[model samples]
Target: MSAQSPIVDLPCALIGFNDLVALLHALFIKHGTSPEVAAILAHNCASAERDGAHSHGIFRIPGYLSTLASGWVNGHAVPRVTDVASGFLRVDACNGFAQPALEAARALLVDKARSAGIALLAIHNSHHFAALWPDVEPFAEEGLVALSVVNSMTCVVPHGADRPLFGTNPIAFAAPRADGPPIVFDLATSAIAHGDVQIAARNGERLPPGMGVDSLGQPTQDPRAVLEGGALLPFGGHKGSALSMMVELLAAALTGGNFSFEFNWADHPGARTPWTGQLLIVIDPSKTAGQSFAERSQELVRQMHAAGLRRLPGDRRHRTRAKSLEAGIEIDAKALQQLRELAGE
Candidate 1:
C-alpha cells in the first residue's frame, strides 16, 4: 500500500457536491490516478453516496487508492465487452477495479434494455465492488426493474460447518416507485456484511447474536475473532445460504471466474488474489405493462406507504444524502485526517 500523509483534524463544513468531487479527484490524482479516470472514480463514489450507499461512498477511497498502489488493479485500463448480443452482454474488467466496468456495463445494458425490453450482463476479472445497490438503482430510476448479484472474497461459512466456504455474495433488486426514491433492496447474503464486521472491529464492539463463528467453528460475538479466523453466518439460515450459492453460480460460474471459496483472498502478491464477478439483469416494465407501469408502480407505492411501513429500503439513504448535500459531506473527522495524511497533505 502507498504511504498516506498525516491526519488533520477539521470540522465538517458546507461544500457543494461538485466541490467535494473535485477534492476527491485531486486526491486520487495525487495518489497516482490518471486525471480522466480519477474524475470518473470520484463521480462514481459520490453517486453512490447520493443514492445513500455510505459503505461504498468516499470511505472506499483508501482501498481503491491502495489497490492502485499495489498493482493489484489497473487504474488506467479500460474495460471491454465480449459476446455482445441483443438482450445479453458480457464484459471483461481486464484486472481492474469493478466500479468503472460496472458503470459502463450498466449504461450499456440500460440502453440495450430500452431497445430490447430486457437485457442480462455478466462481468468477470473485476475487484471487490463496494456496494451492489448503486449498480441497480439507476435502472429503477429509469422506470425499469433491475436485479444484480456479485461474488466476493470468501468470508461466509455455510450452515452446520465452518472455515469460510463462500463469499458474502451480495444481491440487490430495484423497481420504480410512484413517489420518493426507487424501491431498492440490497443486502449481503451473509448474516452481516464484511464492512459491518470491520466497523465493529474498528470500534472494538461486539457483533450481535448469530452473526459469525470463530475459527474453531463456534459462534462468537467478538468481531476481532470473526475477522481473524471466523466466518460470517448465512442470513435466514439455509435460505440465505442457498441464495449465496445461487449468486456464486450465476455471477462467477457464468462469467468463467473462480467460484466461491476458490477465489484468491490475499491482497499481496503470492497470496490469494481477488477475482470478483457480477451479473446484472434489467427489465423494462413498460414492455410488459403497456405504458401504465409507472402509474401502477406509483399506486402500489402509495398503498405501501399508507400501510404505515416507514423507511423503505433506500429511503433513509436518500434522506441522508440530501442532508449531507445540504450540510457538506459529513465525513468523519478521523476519516478525513487519515485521507489527508495518505495524500501527504
Candidate 2:
C-alpha cells in the first residue's frame, strides 16, 4: 500500500484535506454507503491521497461505484462484533467495506489490548480495497505496536506455479517511538500492487522488468498486458510466496473469510474488490518489553541514521503528509472533476 510513483506532467490542482474528505464522503453516500460507512471510507481514502499513496487514493472511486451498482457489496451493512476471548475480538463485516468494521470495534480492541497486554481482531466477510497502513498506524500513535494483514483478489502467481492464485496480500506494521512519529511500513507480497499496475495501465506507463508476466506466461513490462489476463509475480520469489500463503491462512482461514481464489464475481461484472478478510494484532509493548519500548525504538532509529541511512520506513510519507497539510494535497485536475461529478456537484 505504501509504494507510490508520482504521475509527473499531469494537470494538477490543490485541495484541502477536509475538503477532499467531504467531497468523497458525499460521493460515497450518493453511491450507496450509509453516512457512517461513508465517513470512515472517505477519511481512509483522503488520508491515502494526502500521504501520496496515489494508487489507493481517489483512483479507486470508480471501482467502488461500480461494485455498489453491481450489488456486489452492502454499503449500509452494520458490523457485528463478537467478544470471543479475553484477548481476541471478531467482527463480521456483513459483506460491507472493512474500514467501518474496524471503526466499529476500535474502542473495544484498544480496551482489550490495554487490559490483556495484547489483543487480536479478526474481521471477516469484508471488502478491503484501501491501503493497509491506515488500519494499524493509529495504534502506534497511541503508544502501541500493531501488525495487520489482508488478502486481495487473486492476481499473483506463486513462485513455482504456472497460474495466478494468491492475492497481492499486503502486510503492515507500526510501532511507537519516543523521538517522533511511529515507525510504520506497508508492502504487498507481490512485486507490485495490483492497483499500481492499474495506475500504470491507465497512465500508459511501462513497469520495471520482472514485475509481471503476460497471459502467455512470458515476462512483460507492459502494465496493460499484465492487467489483461496476465499476472504479477512474488516480490522475492519463494519468500514472498510463503508470506502470501501465511497471509491467506491468517486473514482468510483463521477469520472465516473467503480465500482469494474462492470468491467468484462472474455474475457481478463491475465488482473490482475482493471479498475477503483481515487480521490485526495490537501489542502493549510496555507490558512485555520490560523497558521503555518507545525509547528502544528511538534508539534503533538513531543507530540507523548514524549508519548513513537517509530515510526510515515512513519518513517520506510523514514528510509528504506534513507538506500536504501545510499546502493542500495535489491531485490530477481531471480526477477531481470526475469526483465532483460523482458527488453530483
Candidate 3:
C-alpha cells in the first residue's frame, strides 16, 4: 500500500495475484459455482484489482456469493451463442455472470468483425457486476474499436425528477493505439456509480458534491442517504440522463433483457443476479479508414503526448496494472477478512 494513502487501525494485506484468484475460485466453488464459471469470475476480479479498480474487485465478492447462494445465478451456465443476422450475434447468458458469456464469444465475435467490418454482440439474461473496460479492452488490443454498454438495477433519478427511474448505466469505449496501450475508458452516466456510493458507505466516508440526493429529493453528499431510500444524480444533468436512457435502449430493449425499473425490489430484497443485459460492438477500423488508420491514430496520440498537458485514457490503469503484476495486489483488510471467511479458511 502507498504510504500517502490514509492508514486505518487494520493494515491492508498485499496478496499475490495468483493467491487472490485462487481464493476467489475457492469461494465461488463453495457457493456452488462450476469451476469454469468460477475461474471466469476470478479472472475478472483479478483483472479489476490489477487495474486498480477495487470497487469491482474483491469488494464485490460478497454480493456475488450471496446471489449465487440464493440460487438465482446459474453457476454452470455455458452461455449459448447464435447467429442473428449480418454481423450480428446473440448470446444467451442463462442467468449467469457476464464474463464467461462474453469470453466464450470473444474469438468468434472478433473474427466476425474482422471479416464484416463491424459486428454486434447482444448479451441477454446476463448479470454484469464487473467493470466494462475488461470486456472491451481486449478487443481494442486487437486493433478494433470496441464499444460496450450495460444497465443495472435502478438507483439514479431521471433528469428533473425526484424519483429513481434509471440505473447508473455504464458505457465503455476503446480504440487501438500503436504507440501505447489501447485508449480505454469506462464510466457510469450517474454522477457517481452505485457501487462507489456503497464503497464509500462501507468505508465510512462521505461523498463528493452533486453525487446524489436524499430521500426528499434534496441534494446531499452523504453516502448513507444516497444509498438508503435516496437516489443518485445523473451526471452532466440532462446529457447524462439522455445517455442513461440510451443505455437502457441499447442494452436492455435491443438485447431483450429487463430494464432497470423492471426489477421488483419489493418482491425480493435479498441478493440476486442483476438480471441485466449488455451490448457490445466491435469494428475493424482498418476496413473503414484503410491503411492509414494506424498512422493517423499514432499521429494524434503522439501530438497529445508531446503536449504533456493531458494524460491519455487507460494510461494510469496500464501503469497500475504493471505495478500490480510485478508486486502484488493491495487488498483492504476488511475485504481480506471476508475472503477468508468465504473461502472457509
Candidate 4:
C-alpha cells in the first residue's frame, strides 16, 4: 500500500445505480438482513456514490453488516416523531440508521415550509448519515434555503487539549440558483474528514503536520496511529473548536443524544452505541422575494463568477461524478477484493 509500490487496479464494472443497489441488496441479504430493509439501505449507499460521496458509499457495507450482526442497530425499528409544535419537530430514531429517519423528517419540513414559510427539525438516536450536501441539495433546488448539522463519534481534540473531546461535526448550507447548480457549502469542523484519513491509510500516505496526533498525545504522520488511538485537530484552532462545541450542544444536547466527553466511539464494539443527532432547517424563498428571487440569485452568482472564483460549491463533485460514471468507480484492488469476499462473489 506504500507510494513506492505500483498502483493496483480493480476490475471496472459499468452499471447503473439500480444495478449497484441490487448487488448491495444481495450482499446485505447474505449477511442476514431482511430483504426489504436491505433494499432501502442499499439504495441509500448507491445514491451516496452517485452523488460523489465514495467514502460513505459501498465501502460502508461491511461495517453496517457487522453492526447488524452485533445488534447495535435494530434493523426492524421504525423512526417516530416524539414532538411537534409551531414550526419545529423532533424525531427519535429508536436505534436505526439516520438516513430513513432524516429523510422522513426532511420531507415533513419541506411540506410544512411550503405553507408556514419555514420549518425546523431535530433528530436523536440515529446512526451515521451520509454526505450532508445530498440531503440539502433537493431543498435548495426547490427554491428553499436549507441548513443541516450532524455530530459523529468523538475523534477531534479541542484547542490546547491533548485528549479527544468532540466529533468532527459537519454542517451544510444550500441556496438555490436560477441558472446553475445550487450554492452549497458542506464541511467538517476538523482539519480533515475522518474518511480522508482512512483513505490515506489505505494508500500508505502520511497526514500533513497538525492534522492529527498519536496515542501518546504526540504529533504523528502515521495514519494507523491516528486511526487507532489518536485524534484529528480542529480546523482553525479555537474557531474550529468553538464551532465543534456549538454543534455538540445543538445536535447532541438539544436533541437528547450523547455529547462532548460522553460521545461513543465507533471503533469500540462493546461501547455504548453512538446514537448521533442531527438538526435541519428550511426556509422558503418565495415568501420573501415573490417571483424575482431566482433572478437575484442568478445575478449574485454572475457577479461572484466575474470576480474570478473558478469553481462553485458543488461543481467539483459534479465533475467527479461525471468521470466516475464514464469510467466506472476505480477502487483499489485490495478494497475491491475485500468487498467481493464480503459479498461471497
Candidate 5:
C-alpha cells in the first residue's frame, strides 16, 4: 500500500534498518507473538518502511497488536508443509500469519522450482495483513522469477455488481535483471487498498472520486464512510474484477481456504487481518529460456527506457531503499515515539 498521508515535512527522525527491526520485534513479542514469529514479522514490516511502503510498515503495528490481543490469529502456530507433487507444495498455517508459513516452506519451494522448472505453493488458514511484494521479491533476489497473490477481506464491489463480494486482492510479481535490481510490482485490484483507506481516514483525508461507495451503494469520498459501511470499486472495472475472481480461485479455492465472503471475523473483535490464503508460483527461467534470462529482462527494460518510460514499477521503492541504507529510514517523530511506547522502551 502507498502512503496516503504525506510526512515529508513532518518532524522526523532517522533510524537504522536493524534498529527498527529490533523495535518491531520487541513490540510483537510484547503483544504475545512467539520470538520466531516476531522475528519474521518484524523484518517484513521493517522492510516495508525501509522501502517507503508506509501503509504496511509500522503504520500497521496497532492492527497487529489488536489482532493478537483478540486471539483471532495464533501468534505461535507452526506451519505444516505437504509436498503434494514434484512441483506443488501446500502449507496449512494453523491459523497463523502467512509470512511465517511462506518462510517455513520457501526452501522446499525453491528446491522444487529448480528441479522441476516451476513450482507452486498454496498456503491456507492464514492471515495476511502486509504488502504482498515482500513475499515474492526475495525469490527474485535469489535469481528465481516469482509471482504471488492473496485475497483480503471482502470490501470491493465486483464490476456491474450492487454490493461488495471481492477482496482488494493483490497481485505481485518479481523477476531478476542483469543490469539492476529485480523488476517488481505489487498492485491491488481495487481502486485503492484497504490500508490506504484506513490511513486516509485516520489522517482526515478524503478519497478521490470513484474509489468507493457508502452503505447505500452511493458514491462517497469520505474515507470513514468507506471503512465504516461502504465498499471499494474495482480498478478498471471488469478487468480488475476478473483478476480478483482469478485470485480468489487461485489463493482460496485451490488452497482449501476461505473465500472473501466466507470469512466472518465479526466474532473476533479487533481482528483486522484477513484470514484467507496465498498462492505463489516460482519459475526457473534458465530451464526454458533460450538466452540468459536476466540479460533478456535487462534488454526489455532498456527498450522500455528507449520508448520514454521514466520509471518502472518498483523504481521508487528501489530508490528509497538505497537512500534508507545510506541515511537511515526517515519516519515521523511522533510515529517513532509511538513505536517506542509499543515496545515498552
Candidate 6:
C-alpha cells in the first residue's frame, strides 16, 4: 500500500492568487530556482489553482523543488529559439521549465503564423509541470488558433493491453470566437488523469467504473491500485490510444526529446523532473480564410446551443476563474503547510 498523505485530515484554506503566487515564488527561489524562472512558475501555478485545475496547482511544488535540488533541471537555464524553416520555430529549453520556453516562443510564433498562415514550434529539454491550455490560450486570445501537446512520464497503458507505456499525454486546442472569449479545451487521452488518481488516493476515494486496471493488468476501480502499480486506460479505447500515440510522437519524436519510457528510465526514481517535451502550433485564421474563420466557428457554436447543449469545455474554467478572482482560491491545508516549510517559514 502507498503511504497516506500528511494533509488527509488537515483543513482547507482560502487564499488569493497573489498571496499564493508570492508564497510559491519564495519557495522556488529558496530551492535555488532563478528569480525569473521562479516568477514564471509561480504565475502558472497560481493560474492553475485559480482556474480550478487542482492537479497542476501548488500541489506540484514538492516534485518541482525535488528536481531543482537534485539538479535534474536547471533553474537558471535559458530557452533558445530559432526559425528553422518558413513555418517551423524550434525552442530549446536547456533543461529548465516549459513556461518560459513557451513564453519566449509566443510572440515569434504568433508573428510567424500570421505571415505563413500557420507555424509550428518544437520544444525540448524541458520539465513541463502544468496544463497545456495556458500555452494555447494566449494565441487564441490574440485571434489565432492554437494547438499544443506534451508527453510526460508514462503512467498509462496502451489499448488492448496493460502495463505502462504512455503518459496521460494531453492535448490542448483553442480558437477565436465572434463573441465572448475564445473556445478552448485541454484533455488527457487517458480515461482518468494520473494526477486525478493521485488526488483520489489522497482523498481516500474510489475510482469510477472502467477507469483503469490494477497492477496485475486486470480492470479495477480502485484508485490505490491504479496509483501504486497499475495503469490507466485510454479514454475511448482505440481512438484515445491513437491520439496518445500522436501526442507522444509530436511532443517527443518530432521535438527530438526523450520519450515517456526514456524519461522514466533517465530519472533517479523520486523527487526528480520528468524531462518532458511539448509541441505548439499556431494558425492565423484570418490569414487562412479571411473573416469566414470566425463566422463559421461562431455558426458551429450557435448550432451547439441550438441543439440544447448549454456549455462547452472551457466554460466551467472561466466561471471558476471569475469566482477565484473575486473570492480567492482555496488550497488544501496540508499543501499550504508544506509550501510554508519549503520557504523556511
- Model 4 scores what on Cα lDDT? 0.76
Model 4 TM-score? 0.88
TM-score of each: 0.89, 0.96, 0.93, 0.88, 0.96, 0.93
Clash count of each predicted structure: 7, 0, 0, 0, 0, 0
Q: What is the lDDT of residue 51 in candidate 1?
A: 50
Q: Relative to the unseen true structure, what is the C-alpha lDDT of residue 305 in candidate 6, on a scale of 0 to 100?
A: 92
Ten residues in sequence with the least summed lDDT for candidate 2: 1-10
Better-scoring candidate (lDDT), 3 or 5: 5
lDDT of residue 171 for candidate 3: 95
In candidate 3, how many Å is residue 58 off?
A: 0.1
Instruction: Show the colliding residue pairs in model 3.
Output: none
- Please write out the lDDT profile of model 5 over residues 1-345, one tens digit for every residue: 113343444699999999999999999999999999999999999999999998899888888988998989999999999999999999999999999999999999999999999999999999999999999999999999999999988899999999999999999999999989999999999999998998888778999999999999999999989988899999998999999999999999999988988978789888888899999999999897488899999999999999999999999999999999999999989779878988999
What stretches of model 1 exceed 4 Å from their correct place?
A: 1-14, 48-52, 265-273
Deviation from truth (RMSD, Å), model 5: 2.4
List runs of model 3 lying over 4 Å from the truth: 1-9, 265-269
For residues 1-345, write the lDDT of model 2, one tens digit per residue: 111333446699999999999999999999999999999999999999999998889988888898998999999999999999999999999999999999999999999999999999999999998999999999999999999999988899999999999999999999999999999999999999998898887677899998999999999999989988999999998999999999999999999999999999999988878999999999988787466999999999999999999999989999999999999999988778778988999
What is the TM-score (0 to 1) of candidate 1? 0.89
Please give, for residues 71-161, the per-residue lDDT of candidate 6 as tens digits.
7788998899988987999989998888889888888888899999999999999888787888899888888999999998877788876
Root-mean-square deviation per candidate: 3.1, 2.8, 3.4, 3.5, 2.4, 2.2
- Which clashing pairs does model 4 show? none
Q: Is candidate 2 or candidate 4 better by TM-score?
A: 2
Give the alpha-carbon lDDT of every model.
0.77, 0.93, 0.85, 0.76, 0.93, 0.84
